[model samples]
Target: MKRFSALGAMLALAGAAPLAGAAPQPPSCARPEWPQEARRYELEGVTTLNFRMGPDGRAIEPTVARSSRWAMLDQAAIASLSTCVFPAETVQRVQGKLLPLQFVWKLQGPDRVPPALVEGSCAASERFDRYVPFDKGVSGDDGVLVRLLVRGDGTPYGVKAEAGGADPALAQAAVEYVQSCRFAYPKAGASPGSPVSGRVLLKQ
Candidate 1:
């Protein structure tokens, strides 16, 4: 399931870029500007866009990037990139080079949590299970919410305790466990910035 989701996200991103075409090269590098409408469009939700920039600093090919399965927002992202431009230097340097760029669409109002941001359990059999609070005062029975950014292979790139009370010991333990763990790189198509949730539930 995880692999499929990642692949889907990649496909959406791949589809957003422009196809190769025969066009005259510009005489000099020019900074491409993002369409005003797309810029004004709110990316308040959980959406990731991956695109390629040309050596000329223009968004030669734009695609859906990555989205949280929200069609409306995804479409908006596609439309927005159509008008998006890159810096002249970027275009010149990356004209023939294919570099990945990501954009996270956020809304204008107070931050809103997407349904996908919900938490999930870390199986008892998982290696990190050893770090679970075993003592009465040490247990994270209320649960610990940690925001972990893992590489495609599932290795912890970064970790932060977001919520679930202020237990320094519990937080440290969780962070340590995560730091020691590694994950398989996501499937080839997974978006680079894909977000994964980790939940630690203590057992009595």
Candidate 2:
């Protein structure tokens, strides 16, 4: 596993103050109550993120003042905070004000096992069969999982090695191959600019 100890320390130090060019500070207030269901997540080694609420009550910008090495934990914190419903009354009070909200991702317990495959509309078709080659580094090993975000046009916008047991070269090759492959666009409704997430498992 990649060690994030140094990154974590840096985040802690930066978290102590606002960014250099940030807007003036707002009033202090406790975090709004989150749903009971949100407490079920395991967020150990996660970062505590600070968000600035816009006049529309939506998160304007997110900054990781504190982070744990685990990206999953940081993502979870952002996800949970995204669903938060800030006080409408308070929002009106600070119509032009930028409210600072802090979210500490506390791990509930042990991390749960991730699902087998998080499929999306796109997949490796026969034309691109050669691109989905086995990861030679793990010829006799169990396997590794690579998660990627594919754009509506079938172009890969982002790639990450979800599980890193496989060789770095293999993971890079898979990412490059996937980026080169194209997919059929959605026929029904309008294509979304947002990325569609999927997983590729390289096994022995």
Candidate 3:
């Protein structure tokens, strides 16, 4: 899966960053499903949408300022971001806001977009606003793959190392770092059905 990206519409400066106060921006962790028809024919394009969010973390207008020229692609892009959960109050301090984002739909020639390319801003542990990996200058750099269990409200719990035999200290550090992170889930309220896990690559 090759990386493809384009600038989406920019929000007008009228509102500025909300004064609501310190909520970490939730990162995108999934991709909207590609239209089967589009995938069958190997259609690919980038859709740019201007989405509005309320203080309650719901999406308002999901208009495509820039079309992918493919209606199915555009709709997929809008629907996913429009309905997904976000940290409460969106921008922390801002009470209400408009967020414009661009979603690129590139077929992998394998039926689905790869998961690694799903979260645009999330980089393993870096996606969490609070999971800071330990850095030991020369002590030895080690890494662990952990499945971070994210609850409906975006709180990360059960940071289980997916593999065995990782250094105990390094693994423990990853768990602790993840425990410190928090997330906000939208309409689903406090629990988002079942536990959703995201894998994090931790290095120390």
Backbone N/Cα/C clashes per model:
33, 1, 7
The true-versus-predicted C-alpha distance at residue 118 of model 2, in Å, is 16
Task: Tell me the spans in candidate 2 whose CA falls farther than 4 Å from its real position.
Answer: 1-70, 74-141
- Cα TM-score per model: 0.32, 0.32, 0.40
Q: What is the RMSD, in Å, between candidate 2 and the native fold over all Cα? A: 15.3
Clashing pairs in 3: 18-94, 20-93, 20-94, 21-93, 23-92, 152-192, 154-183
- Per-residue C-alpha lDDT of model 3 across residues 31-75, encoded as one tens digit per residue: 567776555333455677766666556667778776765566777
* Least accurate 10 contiguous residues by lDDT in model 1: 3-12
Q: What TM-score does model 1 achieve against the real structure? A: 0.32
RMSD of each: 16.3, 15.3, 19.1
Model 1 root-mean-square deviation: 16.3
Number of the top TM-score candidate: 3
Report, for every candidate in turn, its global Cα lDDT versus the true structure: 0.42, 0.42, 0.48
lDDT, model 2, position 177: 49
Residue 41 lDDT, candidate 2, scale 0-100: 23
In model 3, the worst 10-residue window by lDDT is 109-118
